[model samples]
Target: MTTGFETDRISRRKAIWREIPAGIWALGFVSLLMDVSSEMIHALLPVYMVTVLGTSALTVGMIEGVAEATASITKMFSGALSDWLGKRKLLAALGYGLAAFTKPIFPLAPSVGWLIAARFIDRIGKGIRGAPRDALVADISPAHLRGASFGLRQSLDTIGAFFGPLLAIALMWLTANQFSAVFWIAVIPGFLSFVLILVAVREPKRPEGLRRIRMPFSRSELGRLGAAYWWVVAVAAVFTLARFSEAFLVLRAQSIGLPLMLVPAVLVIMNIAYAISAYPVGVLSDRIDRVTVLIVGLFLLLAADLLLAFAPGAIGLVLGVVLWGLHMGFTQGLLATLIADAAPAELRGTAFGMFNLVTGLALLIASVTAGALWDATGPQGTFLAGAVFTLLTLIGLLPVQTRLGKREAS
Candidate 1:
C-alpha cells in the first residue's frame, strides 16, 4: 500500500516546468482553452435566458439541471469505458473536441431551445471526457508533488477562466453588443484543446490483468479503500448540493441592478480570485489532510450564502461572489486528488466516475431546487436554502473526522 505522499519522485524537467508531465500539463492547457470558451458563453447564458430568450427562472434552472445531468452520466460512463478500454487520451480528446465543435453552434442559436440543445451536446462531451482525464492525471502525477501537479494544472485551467470573460467583454465592446461573434470565436480554443490532447498527451496502456478483471462494475470487489471513498463521496454530494451554480449569482447580481455591461467584470473578478488561490491551496492540501481544505471551502460557501441572503448592494454581492471563487479554489482540485488517493489502482476511473455521477446529479437537483425556492420565496430564500444545507454539511463532518482520525491512528 504505497501512500500518495510516498510516491514523491519527480524528474528534473518536471521540476523546472519545462515539461511538467504531459498528462497533467495537458489538462491545464486544455482547460485554459475550454474555460476561455465556456466562460465566454456561460457567463452570458443566464442573461440570454432571462432577457433575450424570455425564459423564467424555473426554465433557466431546468436547462442547467438538464445540462448537469447530461454531464454526470456521460462522465461516469466515459470514465468506466476508459478504464475498461485501457485507453484515455483519445476519449478525452473526443470529449473536448465535441465540446469545441459545439462552440460555434451557440452563435447560431436563435431560441432558448436551440441554446439548450447546444448546452446538452457540450455537456455530453464534458461528461464523456472529464473523469478519464482526471484519472489520467492521478495515474501520472507522482505522489509527493501530487498537490503541485494538480495545483499547477488547476491554475492553468483557471487561467482560461480568468481570461475568458475579459475576452468576451472586449468582444462585446468591439462588436458593440454582438454576443454571437464572441461565441463563434470561442470555437477556436476548443479546437486547439482537441489538438493538444491528440498530439501532446499520451495515455499509458491499460494496466495488466485488466482482461481478467470484471467489466462494468463488481460491487462485491469494492476493496480496502471502498469505505473511506464512499464517505468522501457522500460528503462531496452534500457539497455539490450546497454549492449550486454561479448562474444564480449572476441572476442575483442582475436583480440588484448590476448593469449588463459590468457583468463581465464581475466574472473576471471572481475567476481571477479563483485562479490566484487554486495552486497555493492545492499544494497546501497535498501537505495537510485534503479534507481540511475541503472543509474550508464548505465554510466559505456557508458564509457566502449568508452574505448573498442579507447583503445590501453590489459591493456585498461582489464580495460574496469572490468568496464563492475562493471556495472553489480550496476544494475543486483537492477533491479530485482525494478521490484518487482513496481508490484502488485499477478502479480509480470508476471511483471518479461514480463520484462525478453522484455530484453532478446532485448539482442538477440543487440548481432546480434553488430556482424553485427562489420562485417560492425569492433570492433570499435560495440563499437561506443553501445556508441550511451548508450548516448541515458542516455538522455532518464531525463523524467523518472521527473515522478518518481513527483510521490514521490505527
Candidate 2:
C-alpha cells in the first residue's frame, strides 16, 4: 500500500502536470530537441577547430564569441518583430527552421571560414527563436507557476544538452572520431525540432480588435516596462560577463590530459548536474525570495571558478564542473522567470530581446578576454579572473536585492 507521504507526492506531481498548459509542454520538448541538435555540434566544435582546422585558442574564442553575439543582436529585431506582428509561434517556427537548414553546413564545410559562417547562421536561428519562445512560455503560464514552468523547460533542454554529448561520444567511437560524421547525425534532430514546434505549439490570441503593432518600444511601451525589468537585464548582463562560454571548459579538460573522444564527457557531466538541479531549484524560487536563490547561484559560480583555477587533477576538475552546472541550473531559469514577472505581457518579447542583447555583448567581450588571458597566463589565470568578476557581481547584488526585497514586500 502507498503511504500518505507517497500519495501526497503523487498528487502534487499530478497537480503540477495539470497546471502547466499543453503549449508549455510542447515548447519544452521543442527546446529539448533543438538543444540536442545544437549541443551535439557545440560539444565538439572547439576541439575540432583547434585540432583539425589548425586554429588557435584565441580563434576558437573569437568564433564562439562572435557567433553568440550575432544571435543576441538578431534577437533585438526578431523579438521586436514578434511583438509587432503579435505572433510568437510563427517567428519561433521560422527561427527553428532556419537553424535546421544550417545543420548541414557544419559537416559540409571544407574550411574554417565556412565553419564560422555555419556557426553564425546557427546562432541567428537561436537568436530569432530565443525571445519569442521565452515570451510564449510566459504568456501561456499562470503567474504563480511561472518559475516552475521556466524551470521545467530549462530542465528538459538541459536533458538534451547532456544527451547530445553522450550521443556524440558514441558516434565518435562508431566513426573513429570523424567529426563530420557525428555532425551528420545531428541534422535529423534539428529538423524534428522544427516540425514538432510547427505541428504541436499554438499561440494564444491577442486582445480583441488589437491594432497591428509595428514598433514595440515607443516611449509609452518603455514606461510600461518599468524599472524592475531593466534591473533584471542589468544583472543578467553582469552574470554573463562573469561566465564565459562553456567551450573553455572543454579546453581545460583537454589540456588536463583527457583524450579527444572523452572531451564530450566533460559537457555530459556538467549538463547532467544542470538537468538534475534546475527543476528543483526553480521550485525553490517560488517558495523563497528569488534574489536570495540567485545570490546562492552566484556564490556557486565563484566557488566553481576558484576550484577550477586551483584544481589539482581529474577529481578537482570534476568537482568544479559539477559546481558550474549547479550554478547554471540555479540561475538560468530564475533569471528568465524574473524577466517574465517584471515585464508587461505585451512587451515581454522585447524585454527578453534587450536582456539577451546586452548579455550577449558582455559574453563576446568576456570570451575574447578569457581567450587572451589563457594564451598569456594559462588556464589558472583565466579562471582566476572569472572569480574576480563573480566577486564583483556579488558585491553589486547587495543593494539591488535589498531594494527589490522592499518593493516585493510592499
Candidate with the greatest TM-score versus the true structure: 2
lDDT of 1 by residue, 355-403 (tens): 9999988887898899899889999999989988888777767666666
RMSD in Å for model 1: 5.5
- Candidate 1 residue pairs in backbone clash: 8-144, 75-127
Candidate 2 residue runs with Cα over 4 Å from true position: 1-10, 44-63, 107-117, 176-181, 208-214, 254-261, 402-410
Give the per-residue lDDT digits (tens) of candidate 2, residues 51-124: 99898999997787678778989998888788888888888999999999999998998999998888988889
Lowest lDDT block of 10, candidate 1: 7-16
Candidate 2 accuracy as TM-score: 0.88
- Regions more than 4 Å wrong, model 1: 1-20, 43-64, 106-117, 205-212, 221-225, 399-410
What local lDDT does model 2 show for residue 201? 91
TM-score of each: 0.85, 0.88
- Clash pairs, candidate 2, are none
